[model samples]
Target: MTDHAGTAATTLGISTAGLDLEASVALAAEADAAGVHAIWTSELYSMSATVSLAAMATGTRRCRLGSSILYGVGRTPLVLAAEARSLDKLSGGRLVLGLGNGTVRMLRDWHGTDPSAPAARMEELVTVVRKLWRIHEGRVHHDGHFYHVDITPTGDVRPPLRECIPVYLAGVNPRMIEVAGRVADGLVGHPLFTLRYLDEVVRPAITKGAGRMGRRAENIRITTMVIAAVDEDEEQARRDAASQIAFYASVKTYDRALAVAGFAAEARAIREAFARGDLEAMTAAVPDRMIDAIAVAGTPRQVRDALRRYEGTVDHVILYAPTLGLAAPRADRNVRRLVAIATAPRDGAR
Candidate 1:
């Protein structure tokens, strides 16, 4: 049961989740200068992940560029294909295309996509995108319940920078985790997940799915997004992390994580506070134990020690700036601290 994840070198990255395009681009540049492994953006009703990544690709020179996730059904396969190809070309093939199935409300109400059998829709999205990417030779064809496509390359179109851009699917549900292991290049663990959840449930499910396909689970990268609210003021840092955790906990879709981390009561408290629209009560519901189990929030030294635990759980760890009840400037400051934390030297040179 020991993942021994720390035995291998774990890459560190940063997420631009709450920042605007200008701030994100600037942070990406800074992270690149510090030699962080990758920089990721999120598309959460504020900005297009692809659009933000395009700017980041042009701004940075070394680090890999990615989306924490674009929703699975938000865009047509053709649109996604075009955007992914464009971003990859712009980044010189340094794109990791992350996708996910949004909550049922997001799918049914926001995007008008049917929410029934979401895993199947996500699988079809992945398949169709890859098919669209491989339009160099013969006609590409796909007929699925969620998507339909038949196309041929024309006008001597230039091939995409890479035949297969690494596709990372984000999810915590067992079915989605298994499907991600079967079809995608990586699994993006949500910020709410703990190391216990990753080892106890996520990894085993991925292994089972990969085995069914005769594929090696080791090849599928296990990446996690962590809520990191770094500050010299430890209390302020913890508050930021708690606020973000409360927000994620309020979403019923992620309630399973609370049970896995042994904090279901606290989660229920947070959800109740959320339903009452009391942000402070929601944040108050996040006990220190939950914060310690799921996030890094404190001085730089404390955060460095906390991150070592995750070194054992994933191939990559993305430090996300918390946004719930946090101001833009404060969130931006958190990102700067995360960059400093990520770029700090190890205790001893190997």
Candidate 2:
């Protein structure tokens, strides 16, 4: 087990917004040079993560690049494996493949794919991708309902890269965590996780899943995502954070996570108020306690203190900076501030 307290080691990562691919690549290179450990690209309504990562791989020399959470059903497992292998080779084996079963809106409405039986589909996808990576020359066979692959490549389709590309599964549900424990190298906890849920629910479930494979809990790297906003004016920062929280809270997936975090009463009230167009109640429901439970908001010093509160609990804290309303210069400054605090010597070690 790696000691969480040693050196206060932390990985500084960022999820790029809807920006030009070329600009994003340059920003990634700049971030890498600024001592950022990893860079994660998302496949939202914009460019695909693979394409963005490919560009980033060419732009940066040392930083690890990966998809924050690529949908498992978004692409074929074989193709996904091939792309990951290719990116690994391109980036000199600094590629981490992060996979997850995305939201129903993305799967069904946007991508026009079936969302029924997602667990079965994800299981099959993980199996097929691993088989594709491990096997050399054979027709992979799976008797699963969602996936059945039996094709062999004529040429050299094997992943020649020797470095282990860590697969991090983004999961909040128990079954999904079990899948992660059984197959994935790491688990990315949801953004809505609270300290209580982490101790009582999430950690226990992860342990149970890992125990099934005769593996210790410490072997699995757990990365928790936290929405963060830092500014001199604390009230403005809280208001900014509330808008972002409201957006995710309205989503069913995150709403469930919030409820699990002991916010069921508040969540219900917020939902009811929102339905009735009560903006005041909606904003009021997102109190400082709720924001502090799942997010880090305040000045730079305060943000750093809040992060250190989870020092012994989580392995890595991926801070999601607010880039929605702020200008490029301001947002970049905030990002630099966060990176500085996150990578600084802990407890006045310096």
Q: Point out the worst 10-residue segment of candidate 1 by lDDT.
A: 1-10
Q: Model 2, stretches more than 4 Å misplaced?
A: 1-10, 17-23, 135-138, 276-281, 324-329, 348-350
Question: Distance (Å) between predicted and true CA of 45, model 1?
Answer: 1.7
Clashing pairs for model 1 are 5-312, 6-312
Model 1 gets an lDDT of: 0.87
lDDT digits (tens) for residues 1-350 of candidate 1: 11224556677889998888999999999999888889999997778888899999999998999888887687899899889999999999999999987888988898887889998788888889888887776688888887888887677877888878899998888999998878898999999989889988899988988898898888888999999888999999999899999989999898887798898899899889988999999999999999999999899899989988876568888998888777788777888888878877755411
What TM-score, over all chains together, does every model reach?
Answer: 0.96, 0.89
In model 2, the worst 10-residue window by lDDT is: 1-10
- lDDT measured at residue 48 in model 1 versus the true structure, 0 to 100: 86
Number of clashing residue pairs in every model?
2, 0
